[model samples]
Target chain A: MRRNSPLVPYLFVLPLICLLAFVFGLSLIRLVEFSFKQVRGIDGPWIGLRNYELVLGQPLFWESVIHNLKLFLTIPVMVMVALVLALLLYERLPGWRIHRTILFLPYILAIPIIAVVMKEMFQFSGPVNAVLTALSLDFMVLDWIGSADVALWTVMGLIVWRETALGVILFLSRLMALDESLIEAARLDGASWRQRAWHVLIPQMRGVIEFFVVISAITMLSAVFAYVYVIGGGRGGPGTATMVIELYIFNALIRTSLPGIAAAVSVLLFAVSLLLIWALFRVRRREEA
Target chain B: MTTTARRSPTGAGMMDRRRLLQAGAGLGALTLTGGLAGRALAQTPTLDMWWWGEQELPGLQAYLDKAIAAFTEAQVTPMLQDTAVVISQFQTAAAAGEPPDLQYLWNGIYHMESVWLGYLAHLDGLMDDGLLAASNHGPLSRFDGHVWRMGWYPLPMPWYYNKDLFDKAGLNADAPPATWDELLAACEALKTAGVEPFGGGVQDGYWAEWYITHGLSQNLDSVGDAVNLFIGDLDFREPRYHQHWVKLQELRDAGFLNKDMASLGLYPGIDLCVNGQLGICSSIGTRLPADAKTTNGRIGCMVLPVFGQGALAGRPVVDMQGMGIAAGSEAKEAAASFLNFLNQPAQLASFWEATGWIPAASGFDDSVITDASVKDLWTRWGKGDPITNITNLMPGQFYEQAAIPTGQNIITAGMSGEEAGELAARVAQEWRDFNPDLVEKYQQWASELSAG
Candidate 1:
């Protein structure tokens, strides 16, 4: 029997298994059970696919799904911005450290504080409007976060502002770890900066890029709740335009008292997260193979 | 000794291990029991009470403590909660078959659906036992023939105006708008003078008041049955709803209300009113002084303006807030007793003196309303102010589908008053569809009612 035997792997996994069983596994079981149950006032009875039917039949659920999908598309843009900013700073430009710190500061602000600041900055009489009026750009001024057309996008902007800093720091660390020898070698053949970054640096940073993409996707999906509740001013309004999956679940649970509906929404959210995770794994596996 | 000698080796090993496990189990049980016993003995049958209060609710808390001490002498514990957390907690508790003994429930038909759905326990026996006074029961709290919740305190949702602004505008501050025509003229006068007529942001659900006032006026004819069909089998396409919606839209178009109302919230509105930038602000209660110091020395409280004709004709819509006991409380007697004690004229008066709200209790003397701040409230509510905010007095199903939805619709431009009336009618039909048994149940409850 070797000291570093196959059994050691099992021992290493025991803590994780115990944690999953007690927490996630147990909750998932209850969630499934609840999704199929009937609740009257406080009492519950078994009621097959009735809850799922109600949930899927509602127009609001479809709207939430579409909204979250739109959020998914915006994540890539945010991540790319972060990566480019990090790479620029990593070129050892003047005051790069200071730049890094400034970019990273917003990541530390509390969510509620971020929400309050965002509200103030975007309000009709806020600083942005004042600046616009001063510059004679009054045509560009409108109720930035209050309009139904732009409320969702405003929340996305705030999320990007809050999250891009962390992404920048992550990319910066990855950039620092990159081997400089390949770049120098490639430069000996008269390779330009763009050529080197595209051929050598880009290929090398692909793994880190994939990692950030997966993480950012997950963050963007969950960010819907904080956006709607904190910044969207709590009705998921201007006309339910800002409503998303999390708010849908919350509305069902609080406003409708339909646990079955809430449970179905939870399952759908889980499936969404799982699909994203699987896609990430598939990409990684394909790359490795 | 003989058995040990005869036992197999496996048996002996198992016996020893089992004894050791038993000893460990005993130790664990003793620890839990020992810890719990002390706490159980010290337990003074406390009741958790939740309510909404401002930042400086310490005065109210102290007064509550005095009242509680007088009643149970340290038998109850009142747990204060903010408004945002109350609904979520109550929802969770309702789902779990447990809730606080006494809670400050919103007096709406939507809220009463919980009682109808059996999430709440009826206080029929409690009332019969003389623990709850039949006279103090508000129409909203009365269900079928029985009462479900007690309204211990009444939150008067009224208008807060600036006296100094009115004086500058050449309008009498004492006699505020008693009719729709007067209110419009006042607003027009202030508007011409470049003063903002309505002192609130249109964004932050402030537009509800515009529709609420309209609903109040419409229900003036059926004052006793205010908000009755909010979720009933009624049509939403009524003129009453349209009148309010069209008027609000016109205000939005004309720039009489704040143009950036959608972007600004309550604090900014309050700030504007305080600085005399606004002539009149539609707000409720005697609590405005605590938030901001206005040019007129805090808020001037008056009844909400009513429109239309008949019983609600002369009176202002009295939108209010109040408290109720939980239905499934294990400590029903204690909770009932506490609510009873709290509703007594003396205790109710004390609560108002401390909390700046009026007692919902029916009979109170001039001494109870002696405080300068509360005097305005006493004078207004003296001759039984019309309980407006009819939504608060509606049945649960109707309030959610009809009242709240219609209110939201009027603001969203989703439906006009006629459409809203039609929509309300549709909603009532939907309620009957979803809960096919409710109508008969309500009828039975109505027939069972021997007392008003």
Candidate 2:
């Protein structure tokens, strides 16, 4: 068979390139334009760096940033639990297939459905608290979604519960593709399970681990809107306790109709995401070298 | 010579006659077709209408359908949307200069914002049919001395007490609390009976508006004073406004509010009230009878207890649910005609029967109100001492960014009322600074309000 010409390949991909330019490129340009203007109703007028100043001056914005940073604390716990579960499944333990299916179920569930269920379960007088009280663990009963000190952590716990499935699926696929003979050799050499995990299995899965970390960070930074919105009752409150950058942007845009400030905050969030990705890549490059 | 030219069979004359005959035939056919098309277009004008809140106010869609059927001059297309999506949809339509001919407005921040943006058409000449009393909806329907929207009904937020709970606490079930001190004493009695005295959701944000509006009505003299306070003429730092927060703090400290208020939304709070967990709750008058029925409890409505002597004592904060014609609509006459038809005595009475809401129009038959609680509400509404809700009179930013959040902070973070009041004032000032144009427009409105 004859190969296609180089021009044909470029022509075939031209539509995709055009689509990306029109969708992503144009939106980014418009977003930047909107950030430097005062948008009232439909039209906006140019106003310079005033929107940025206003956004930065808001204490709520800083609080949201702090909340996003706190959510990142869940990454290590999620990764470790997922890796352990995947390793156990790799051992071919009884009911391993059923466990794997159960573990992956939450990943496929819709965010809004999960958020709503979790919000109900974690209410002050909800089933979780009722169970605690019934079990005579009265001291442990808490206002899970209401207290300012506890709401953010509760949201983070929910994120970890829903997101650990993704990590498990990724690690399990990588574990399945591993060489069986290597594990056998390690066992024959009298290496314990923990030692094998530390020396052989963990080293083999470094690339996947790095990829999961980056993706998790990105999700935490920009894609926790539904969780925060539903669980926080759409205001990211009990006094802005669960607020994140996305919620802040939504409140500014939809509730306050301050598109200029929302756009400014969005641009800042984009920068933060870029910085996070860059830092991850730099760390991965160092490890690879 | 003329006779010869006229009778001659020359080639040029023959050609001229043929061209003239062809032109005459073409012109006649064109005129006939144009006339038919114009008549067809005039007979069937298409008008687009968009509305929401049909779920909460059942039978709204049925009423609209009947209205459309009754109006024979135009074909009305009704687009029903969820409450969350309607505002954004209206904004997009307004931007495109092809807004629907008619839209439902909750007549406060939303209506005023649209009016200020020139998205709403003024109904000066159209609303002069004497169908609605000027005093009932005059404050809400008119902005800048022109009617920008036609009010559907006045929704009064009055204090509702469970008569059973009142009796259980040894308080009079027949007579509700009439003063701030009496309300507090009732709360104390309810607390002694191991019951929550008041139920509302601070998490939903609207409860903040309810509290502030209740306080303002008891503290301010007129709607203009409330509007002035909202527009930053009378700052939130004023002692009168600060006193409202102090009163709220006293309630919080007294353990009168529900423990899970910070976690619950409005519906959950309503559930708590209906379940007898709450002794008292503030609710819209339209929802009182239904809420009462759900609880199997006898409920009574009263004005929010006056904290101190003020001009608006015994008045409840009322907001109007209404309709506005879009500025960009092409079928203005047809839309106005539909509105007039819908406001007729029979149709308005039918609406009252279906929705169980007090009608804004005057000629509706009062016999349609069968529910005793609703009838009592109508009697109170007839007294004509209602004040506009602050949420309707203030900017959206003030409520969403400043007041709601500050109220939440007071509940969750243990902030002092003084601190919350100061922060709220700062936020309001910041909003004014950011939107100087809106401030100027508000000042113009204030001047007109004062002159009147």
Candidate 3:
């Protein structure tokens, strides 16, 4: 093939695709196979879809799915917060660099590190409630990480606080690369900041927003394990209140010694994740077109 | 806007020929050293031991390090496992046919699942028989007439009350509550005295587990009865089986548990009693040495007050941690020798001297114990008719999904005792469904235990 041909580009990337297939592909195959078996130690006799039947039939599985759905509520809040923050910074507010760094600091820190600090801070008699009690806001003080009804919400708050930073950075990067001329034209046409953000900049930045939403959807589904692990005291408790799908799968595999059940849940999560990745690709392809 | 692709000269030379040559030289040196080390190590077997304890018992690492050094039979390399990964890591390694020779085994179902999986070697023939018997590995370590693990240390499950708080409440400091009504009366007195009466930190769910360890056994005929509940031979919906939750609920409803109890962890909850902030909480034998010092020996230990009419009521509960040789291990004899060495009278004494806690072996000299509080614990829970920690017999599924959660729900979610029973029954069914293979094994074991 000619060096300039598209086939040459494909050849250049073929090795990585092969490597990825050998690495992740083999495990993915094993994971599906394990899902069909009643796995004990490393392997076990095949039980067909019995693992799936049990996992899906369990109420805890549905509870986990519901919790993940509840987390999906954060994306709208995150998008609004990130858009406003990014737009505000797009104007190059004073000390913007320092402000950006400070805003991004939570994302830079490991989830467990921040989650531990937050767990302590929000404890019933910890600083957050101590301040509330001191200020005569005793009714407002709930068992932040201990009460089942409030623990999942508390986990969501932490997720939003840390995860929104990624959105802010993503949106800000897109905003920075935008056509400033369009915003200036809108300003000249008597468009207010909000109007410019809504009608001009945001409309043009549709691709990044979709990208952020889909990524957040994926995260809330499969990646809130650390937040719940630390905040809910590591067992997704206060009575499984913060039990998301990832923690459910984790408890199945590691804690409960139900590897087949864990694998079944993993397959379900993997399928959902693939859909989100596919959505991510479509958005990217549309933007490129 | 214009963009610059900034690439440094050093960046372009990321894996240059000189660097490759240096890497090759380093690899050659490492290979040479590894060859020499392998030859030197061939005279004696190298036993890999993956253990866990330093998190729960401080100085355990020090004691183990000392023991490993003194163990002359093999070159034992110890890897301290994180609290969460201990079971999974061993099982995973064993499954892969490359398990460490020695593994720290938690009693009952914790290691029994590994036993059932055929990952652990039978300790009966491998280790010293008398020493193994003296180690008190507990009944859960045996199945199909085989022993799986050798006991390492004892965890006596006792409820601690603040003697100072009892006095402050005009209650007898010497006589802790022995009946359910007396416990209620004491809680009332403590409340009147402006002290939080009946809880410790439960945020980590261990306090909840330890509660069941002492509480549920109060209503069981034998440790095997606990197994029957999980294997579907019995149900948690029984009034007697779940009355422990009802008692816990009574405490919650009576405004007896600490207001902050739901937010604290197991150790910190124990601290509430030791520090005189709360009147009572669940505690362990290993904690008594330090806790006794913290409260100036004012901490009183007792079994959870009797409520049920079961045969096991009021018996002291002691859970033991143990060790086993992995079935896949090539150095099984060496591993067994190390476990045997640890249980010997001298090493057991060293364990106590280093960890400030009692070893599981009965051969250890108790005269060396100076702390009055720890001494009392050792005498009462360690000596006479002690029922094994029944929670140790719980299936891991029931433990994480039902047992821990049920206690948590009762305390915090306002879940009634009856509701907790329903939840337990449901989770038990779920466990049976998820693990049909294990259910048959558990049923057989349950029958053998119940008959015993």
Top candidate (lDDT): 3
Ordered list by TM-score, greatest first: 3, 2, 1
For model 2 the local lDDT of residue B58 reads 72
lDDT of 1 by residue, B1-452 (tens): 68756757666445577888999999999999998977875675678777655443336777877887787522776787765556657656765877877776666444566666666667767643353553344566667556776655555555666666777777887777766678778778778777877646544544454455544455445533333343342334556544555555545555666555566665566566667777666654545535333343544666545555445555544543555667767777677667767767678678767775555556544564444545655566534655545545444334434554454444443345556566566656654543444556544433332123
On residues B1-452, what C-alpha lDDT tens digit does candidate 3 reach at each position? 33456556678736878889999999999999999988877878899999999888888999989988998889999999988889999999999999999999998888988888889999999999998899888888889998888988988888899999999999999999999999999999999999999999888998888888888888888878999999878889999989999999999999999988878888888887888899988888888888889889999998888998889999998889988899999988888888889988889888887888888888989999888898889899998778888888888888999998999999999999999999999999988877878889998889878877
If scored against the real structure, what TM-score would every candidate get? 0.83, 0.91, 0.93
lDDT of each: 0.64, 0.79, 0.89
Name the regions of candidate 3 deviating beyond 4 angstroms: A1-7, A280-289, B1-41
Per-residue error for A254 in candidate 1, Å, reads: 2.0
Candidate ranking under lDDT, highest first, comes to 3, 2, 1
Where in model 2 is the C-alpha error above 4 Å? A1-8, B1-42, B132-136, B295-297, B450-452
Clashing pairs in 3: B201-B269
Using DockQ, rank the candidates from best to worst. Answer: 3, 2, 1
In terms of docking quality, model 2 is acceptable
Lowest summed lDDT across 10 adjacent residues in model 1 chain B is found at: B443-452
Flag the better candidate by lDDT, 1 or 2: 2
